[model samples]
Each structure stands twice: as structure tokens, then as C-alpha cells.
Target: MEIEVRDLAGLGEWSAASALYRSVFGYVEPEFGVSPRLLAALHENSGSVIGAFDRGELVGFCYGFTAVEDGVIYHYSQAAAVAARAQGAGVGRRLKFAQAEAARRTGARTMRWTFDPYALRNAHFNFAVLGATAIRFLPDYYDDGSSDRVLVSWDLSGHVPAPSRSDEVVAPSDGRWSAPDPPDRVTLRAALIERFRAGGRLVEVTRRGEQAVYKFREADR
Candidate 1:
């Protein structure tokens, strides 16, 4: 399928993107939904609202805004979602690269986002596919203890090296994609927290035999 990645324009496109976002994430609560008005405002205010279209249909989308911390300017990608049918077809990656290009045009050199630590697919995508590095482990990112996130930073202009084998590995005993059991979840969470606390940065997720393992290396000082 021919996929086109570009900036979304007009109310029609914005509304469609909003609907797809809610649908992909199954957001039932009003508070969890993204309004078209918010997206329009973000588009007007130097934020990117990019979409991947397949034959004029919105297949995937990503949105982010310019941010600054400690005098360093960067782009903060808040959310990205691909339609269920369009997943595994490189649409999400296309949306991200398009978003990064937009950010680069605004003079930003870094892009940051967060993902669930337990989602091994997301971890692999962020570290292995997109060359992002996990810099922080947020215990309760939403303030309601509903989610535990790993904050990742992606260099917009640099070519990051592929991850190498590391001595530190976090592997689940059960070989599950996620830690569903409370005990397993707690153990994995604590291990990741300790690694991040000691200046470790997650660089890769690899498979050793039948189990997936996360690899970390010391962050550059």
C-alpha cells in the first residue's frame, strides 16, 4: 500500500485524527479524549500534528509540541497511534520520522516521549528501531498511579550506534510479553528503577532463546 506522511490540515482532518486516536486507544472517558480544537491550536502554535494516509485515509498519526527544560529546547511527542489494520506496516515509524522532521525545522535537536516499561514491543521499537535511549523511569507518570513510564530521548540529528551486549539484563522468568502477575510486575519494575537510578540507560531489547531481555548501559557523563 502506498502511504503518504504529511501534516494534517483543516477541521475535517483534525476530527478524523481525533477519532482515530480515541479509537486506537479505546478512550471511553471524555477526559481521555483529544479534542479537534486542541489539535488545531497545537498546529497553529509550532506543534506538529502529522498523519500517515493510505489512499486518503488516516492510517496513523502523531502529535507533539515544542518544550524547553533547563535551557535546552526540545520537542515532546505526547501521543502516536496507528489504526489496527495499518499496524506492522511501518506507518508508525513513518509518522515519527515525519514528526521529527517537523521538529527539526523548528531548530530542535532532541525529541522526547514516554512509553510503558512493561510493553516489550514498545521498548524494542523505541530503542532498537528508532534509536532512542531511555533516560528515566517514572514510577507513576500520570499522578494517579495508573501507569509507569520510561522517558526516552531521541536525537533528531545524530546517528546513534546500535546497542551492544551488556552485562545488565532484565528478563522475565515466564517469557511473557508483559508482566501481568503482581509479583512479576513488582520485581521487574524494581529492577528497572534501580538501573535508571544508577545512571543506566536502556539501549536495547533482545531475545535470548525464548525469552526477551532488556539491556542497559551507563549513560555518558
Candidate 2:
């Protein structure tokens, strides 16, 4: 499918972009949906909002803004959504690439975002395709009954790492990724948290059949 991506600038674009979020997220009502005014404010303030279209229909979008964390400025991507029918078609990847390019033009060097660690496909895309490193794992991040997340950071000027695997089991057969080892879940969580706090980075994620293997390396000095 031929997809067109460009900057989103007005209320008409926001209307479609908001609807795309509602559709992909399966929101039951408009009350909990993202509003066009909020998108407009983001567009006006940050100029990081972008959209993808298929024959004039908005099929996907990604937006972020520069934020200060630890006294450093970087792009924080808040959200990106693609229509269900158009998913797995590389639409999200294109949107992210566009977002990165926009960020670079504005003098930002890094982009931060979050994703569910249990989703292998997401893990593959973030680590393998986009070269993002999982720096922090937040438990109950969404409060959707143990739906935890991993905060990912992508360096705009870097390249994807070579493929590798970690001997440690990051996820079990049941797909409960947070519990790497049933007997020492608490210890594993603490270790991961401490590593990131010290600036560690997940260097590679290699899929082995039904399992996704993770490899972590020490923080770069």
C-alpha cells in the first residue's frame, strides 16, 4: 500500500488523528479519548506531531515533545497509533523514522518512549529494528492489572547493535516477562532497576523460536 506521511498542522488533521487513537486503543467512549485541542497545543508548542495517510485517510500518527530529564533535553514520544487493518505493514516504523527526523532538525539527540515488555513483537521492533535500549522497567505502569512497561531510549545518531542473546531468561513460556525467574522475581526486579539507575542499556534482543532472548550490557562511559 502507498502511504503518505507529513506534518500535521490543523484541526482537520487532529480530528482524524484523535479518531485513529480511539480506534487502535479500543476506547469505548469519547470521554477518555485524546482531544484535538490538546493535539493542537502540542503542534503549536513542539511541532513534533506527524501523521500518515492512505488515499487521504489518516491511518497512523506519532507525536512527541522535547522534555528535560536529569537536566538533559530529549524528545519524549507520548503516543503513536495505527489503524488495526493497517498494522504490521511498517506504518508505525515509518512514523517513528519521521518523528526521529523531526527531532533531529530541532537539535534533539535522543528520543524516549515506553512499551509493554511482554509483547515480543514490540520488543523486536524496538530493540532490533529501531535500536532502542530498555533502560527502565516500570511495574504496573498502566495499572491495567499488571501490565508493566519498559522505558526505551533511542539515540538518533546511533545504529542498531549486532544480534546477540543473553543466557538469562527474560520471559518464561507462559509469556510473563516481568517474572524472569519465578523463585527470585523480587531480586530480578531490583537488579534491573539498579542497572538502569546506573545507566545500563539493553544491547540486543534475539528471538529464539517462541522465546525472545534479551542481552544486557553495562552502561557506556
Candidate 3:
């Protein structure tokens, strides 16, 4: 599928934007802050938003609003959603690059957002792909019970110029694994989701607690 990024306010774009988010996030009505009018407002002031389309079908989008947090003004490049079908083929990466350019033009130097730490894919994007290092990890930033959030910060000055080799850093390990800590009941095989920002492999112990799941990261072959 072909992917192109466009200004968020373009005709029929908001409908497509909402649909993309719905497909990607699968959240109920209570969770969202977007409406056609709110999206229009986002287009008028502060930072910008963009959508990825394939053959005239909206497949993905990245949006952010301006905010002052911790006494710092930032254009928080909050969230991006891609059609589930378009994942793995680099749609999300392109959407982010487009937003980065858009944010840069608006004089935004840094971007901040929140994401679930358990999503290995996001870990690859924020750290390995975007060259964004975490300033902190919040245990229950969302307080939703499931999927704890981590507050993320990105510097436009240090953006990655090319698609990241996220594959190389986080390779799946052997099957039926366990963390060294026994009482933890969190049986986890090692999956290298990323490496240290300073340069080393970052391995994650996938499942933590009783009722353990199957092998999370096993040998590819």
C-alpha cells in the first residue's frame, strides 16, 4: 500500500483520523478528547497533525497539542495510530517523521507523550528508532489498572534520520523461560526489545506473576 502524509485539516481528514485511532486503539467513547470541532481547533492553533493515506484511504495519523509541563513548554507529539493492517510495513514510522517535520516548523524543540511500557513495539519506536531516551517511567500514570504508562520525551534536535534497525536489537530468546527470581511467579523468557541508549542490548522479562502465559519471545527458527 502507498502511504503519503497530509495536513490534518484537509477535507474529510478528521473522519479518517478518528477512524484510524479507533482501529488502532480500540477504546470506548469515554476515553477520547477528539471531536470534529476539537480537531479543527487543533488545526488552528499550536502544533499540527497529519494523516497517512493509501490510495485515498486514511491508514494512520499522528497528533499533538502544545502544553507546558514541569515548567517547560513543549509540543507534545502524543499519539499516532495506524490501520492494524498497515502495521509492520513502516506506516507508523512515516507518520512520526511527518509529525516531526510539522512540529519542527512550529518551533517545537521537544516532544512528550505517554505510552504503555508493555508494548515492545512502542519501546522500539521511542528509544531505538526515534533516538528518544526516557526521562522517567511512571508505574501507573494512567491508573487504568492494566497497561501502565510511561511518560516519554523526545528531542527534535536528535531525531533519527533513517528507519531504525529495531529488529537487530531485540531478538527473541529460547522457549519456556523463567526469570532468575523464583518467588516472583513471573515466568519470563528474555526478549531483546532494545538496547541501552548508551549502547547495549535491552532484554525484557515478558510475563510477570502467576497464571503465566506462553513463550513470549522464542527463537525465530
TM of each candidate vs. truth: 0.93, 0.84, 0.69
Model 2 Cα lDDT, one tens digit per residue, 33-93: 8888888887877658899988888899988888878887788898999998789899999
lDDT at residue 144 of model 1 (Cα atoms): 84
lDDT of 2 at 34: 81
Query: Candidate 2: what lDDT?
Result: 0.77
Output the number of the lDDT-best candidate: 1
TM-score of candidate 2 relative to the true fold? 0.84
lDDT of 3 by residue, 1-221 (tens): 87788887854788768766776778677556456566677888876678888888888888888878767677877678888788888988888777777777777777777765445556656666776544444555666654445555677887433433332222222223222243332222122122222232222323334222221222112
The number of clashing residue pairs in each candidate reads 0, 0, 3
Order of all candidates by lDDT, from best down to worst?
A: 1, 2, 3
Q: What lDDT score belongs to each candidate, Candidate 1 first? A: 0.87, 0.77, 0.60
TM-score of 1: 0.93
Give the Cα error of residue 45 in candidate 2, in Å.
1.1
Winner on lDDT (1 vs 3) = 1
Question: In candidate 1, which residue ranges exceed 4 Å CA deviation?
Answer: 161-166, 173-176
* Decoy 3 TM-score against native: 0.69
